[model samples]
Target: MGSEKKSRLPAIVATAVAVPVAVVAGVLVFNAIAPKAEPVHEDLSPVAVEVPALSEEDAVVCLALTATAPESAGGLQARPVEGGAGAAESVMAYGDPAVVATCGVEPVAVEDTALVYKLNGVCWYSDEAGLEWTSLDRQVPVGVSVPETHEQPVDVLNDLSTAIADKVPAAAEAPTGCA
Candidate 1:
């Protein structure tokens, strides 16, 4: 009986050691066969923008307006503007070939016969080619230029009008073509 117990001990010890070794080997083999996870890279290089001189009131208004700008627009993340704090405060950009927004831009002049869109209480005037849209009813006009690659530039205006409505006040008079 003692010999039988001694023989069983070796089998028990071998099982304890082999079980752990097998588990370790299985884990290593699975890791080797599994698909590797690759890190995702996002382009965040600074975008170039030229800042125009603004009136004191326009400057203040633009700073406030830009402060309320969203972190993403038109499915693109916001990129850094090149011209330091002044440009950052007055302008914002998104994606490559960036969609740029400049506060305190020249106000849009909409002819009575021209088309105008009123979105979220903000009036917008689009250029002929639909590349640029300007806020017509804000104290400080905000211009957004969308690249031609974007099929629906008007949607970009619709998205930004919310921020403009929140931060910028209505002009003294409503736009001529916008009801």
Candidate 2:
């Protein structure tokens, strides 16, 4: 009886250890095979937008333009804009401090020294301060304010460029150095 009990003790210990090891290995294998979750922005609250005064025609154009704004920019999801009826003029936003868009803005006045970049057929007047970018070729200028935290402003612009091109008309006088 003593010998039988000692033999059973080793079997019990081995079974306990093997079961736990098997479970841990199975979990690791499952994790490796499963699709990874996409990164998500923490804040989804309405972003505050300071809407500018726009002409009746510009306002109408802006409303239509904003309606076509992209659902996502730079892999971030769109959030609602805060403020009053003026906020309706704004395009969607993504992330905290937000990558925001406002349409029907006054044409950007660029000096010869100003930095202008043509991206996806849209001419952008970029102000390094606050990372603001305004469309220089659109009839009713569109503005985008991207937070410094955003790693890829160009990617964000790329996402919105198609929408801007489809909805906003080109200005008669485009900024110099643009395609």
The candidate that achieves the highest lDDT relative to the unseen native structure: 1
What lDDT does each candidate get? 0.84, 0.82
Give the Å shift of residue 104 in candidate 2.
1.9
TM-score (C-alpha, index-matched) for candidate 1:
0.73
Q: Highest TM-score: give the candidate number.
A: 2
lDDT of 1: 0.84
lDDT of 1 by residue, 53-88 (tens): 898888888889778788887677789898755898
Instruction: Write down the lDDT that model 2 would get.
Output: 0.82
Model 1, residue 111: distance off in Å is 1.1
Report the poorest 10 consecutive residues by lDDT, candidate 2. Answer: 88-97
Clash statistics: count for each candidate: 0, 0
Q: State the lDDT of candidate 2 residue by residue for 1-179, as single tens digits.
A: 99999989999999999999999999999999999999964788888878778888888788887887778877777888877776866556877768988887667798866678877888898876748899999898888889888877989888888888888889888756775
Question: What is the overall TM-score of model 2 with all chains considered together?
Answer: 0.75
Q: lDDT at 39 for candidate 1?
A: 85
Measured with C-alpha atoms, the lDDT of residue 123 in candidate 2 is 85
Candidate 1 stretches greater than 4 Å from native: 1-42
